[model samples]
Target: MSGPLRLIELRPSPNNIKVRLGLRLKGCEFETIPVALDDAERAEVLRLSGQPLTPVLLDGDLPVWDSAAILRHLDTIAPHEPIFFGRTRERIHEVERWERWARGVVYDTFTIVPGMAFRGAFDPAEVERANAEMRRHTARIEEALADRDYLLGDAPTAADLTLVPMVFSTMLTEEQAAASRIAAFLRQHFHLGEERDRTRAWVERLMAHWH
Candidate 1:
C-alpha cells in the first residue's frame, strides 16, 4: 500500500467492528474516520465507494467497501495473521460459509429489534418476536461452540470476528451501555440471558481475547 489505511465507519456497527477487529488481528495500523447517520456523511461514503455505506476502507487511493471485502483486502496485504485462517481451499470455503450464515441469517434476525428501537417505534410484541429469533440464532451458535473453543476450532477466524460482535452487542457491560444508547437499548431488549450460558461465555472469551 502507498499510504496509511483509512477506515470510514460507524463505530457501533457490527460490520464495522468486524473489519476493525480484522485489522487489529492482522496488526495493521489504520485511521478510523467515524461517520454519523446523516445525508452529508452518506454522500461522502457514496463519493468514495459509489455506495452509501459506513465501513468503507480507503487503501491508499483504492476504496474498498463492505466488511467482508475489507477483511479480504487486509488478509491480502497482511497475511501473517490470516483472518480467513490461511489459504487452504476447504478451510476458506468453510469460513466463507460461516460468514454467509453470520451476515445473512444471524445478522438479519439480530438487527430487527434494534432497527425498530432506533426508529422510535417500539412494539413489545414485535420486540419479543425478534428477541426469540435472536435467541434461536444464539442457540445455534452455542451448539456450534459445543465442540470447539472458537467457531472453527482453536483459533478465531473471520467467522468468529463477524458473528461475535453482533452477539456481544446484546450483552454489553455498563460502560459500553453508558457510552452508547444503541448498546443500552440492545442490552435491555435483546439480552441472551443465562439460558445461553455457553454462547455468553464464548462471547466473553472472544471479546477478552480480541478486544
Candidate 2:
C-alpha cells in the first residue's frame, strides 16, 4: 500500500476516466497501464482481476476491479484528504443511487449509442429511440443541478465524480469531441459550454485534477 498504485485502463473508457479523475482529485499519484480492446489485453485483464475489463486497479497483488470499488479503496488508503463517499447513512444512500444512475444509464448511453449509430448497426428508428432514452437521463441530471452546484449538495461527491468523467473533455477524441451527436446532446442538456452554467462550472472545478 505504500507503493504507488497501478491502474489498467482503456484510453476512451468513461469508467476508467472516472477512476483516474477520482484519484487525481484526491491528489494520489498512480501509474496508468493502458489496455487495448483485444483478446490478449482482455486475457491480461482477466489474469489481473479475474474479469475481462479495463480500469482494474492493483495494489501489490490485490486487484480491485470497477471504478466505484477503486474509489472506496482509495478513500481508505488516504483518509485525510477530500472524501468522495458520504459520511451519513442517508447521504450514502443518496450518493449510491446517483452513482448507479450515472454509470448505468447516463454513461452507458455515451458508451454505446454513438458507436452503434456510427457503425449503422442499429436501425434508424431504434437509434432515435435510444437517443430519446439518453435525453431522459440527461434531463434528470439537468433537473438535479437546478438548485445546487453539485448533484447532492454544494460540495463534490462520489456521484459528481462518477458523472463528470462522462462529460470530461478528454473522454473523446478531438475530431469528434465537439462533433458527435452525443456531444451536442451534452451541450444542450449538460450545458457543456463556456457559459456560466452551474453544472458546467462544477465540471470545470473538477478539471483542476487533470495533470
Candidate 3:
C-alpha cells in the first residue's frame, strides 16, 4: 500500500487487460511492465511467477498469478472502492461465471481467429471454424445484454473487465483500432446491426471508462 502496484503483462493480452480494468475500476494506482510473448520474456515471467504467463500482479513482496487471483488480492487489500466481484453472493457468482466464460469461450474465439487470420499460417478450414466459434460466443454475449445494462446488472463488474479486452482483440488492424470508435468497431467487427442495439449501446457505455 506504500507504493503503486506492479503489474507485469503482455500489452495485447486480454487476461492482462482484465486485471488492468479491475484495478482501474477500484481506483487503484498501478504501473504496467509489458513484455513480449517471446522466449526470453516468457522465461522471465516463469522466474517471477513460476509460470510462463503474463498478468502477474506484484503487491509489494507478494506476487499474484492470473487475473482472477490478482482481482481477489486487490479486493483483499484495496477494500474501499468499487467491489470487483460485487457485494451480493448471487452477483458474485454471476460475475465469476461470466468471467470464466470470457476466458474460455470469448477469449479463445477472438484470439484463435485473429491470431490465425493475421498470421495467415492456418488452413482455410481452421479459419472458418475459428470464425464460427467466435460467432457462437458473440451470440451468447448479445443475448446476455438483451435485458441488462451490464452483464450482471446496471453496474459494471469483473465480467466486463474480462470480456471488453477480448472485444479489443477483434480490432485487428490499425485502421480498425483507429478509424472505428467503440460502437462502430463493435458493430463492424461483430457484424452487429439494429438487432444488437442493446449490445452496441452497452459497448459504447463501457468505452466511457477508458475512452
- Top candidate, metric lDDT: 1
Model 3: pairs clashing at backbone N, Cα or C within 3 Å = none
> What is the Cα-based TM-score of model 2?
0.76
28-73 per-residue lDDT for model 3 (tens digits)? 8777777865556487777777887788987876789978888878
lDDT of 2 by residue, 127-179 (tens): 55555665565566667888887777777778988887765632334454566
In terms of TM-score, the best-performing candidate is: 1
Report the lDDT tens digits of candidate 1 across residue range 81-129.
5555558999999999998899899888788877976787888887788
Please identify model 2 stretches exceeding 4 Å from their true place: 39-41, 115-122, 167-196, 207-211
Give candidate 3's error at residue 151 in angstroms: 0.4
lDDT of model 1 at position 188: 79
Model 1 is weakest, by summed lDDT over 10 consecutive residues, at 78-87
> What overall lDDT, based on C-alpha atoms, would model 3 receive against the true structure?
0.68
Clash list (residue pairs), candidate 2: none
Model 3 Cα displacement at 83 (Å)?
1.8
Q: For candidate 2, what is the lDDT?
A: 0.69
Flag regions of model 1 displaced more than 4 Å: 39-41, 209-211
Clashing pairs in 1: none
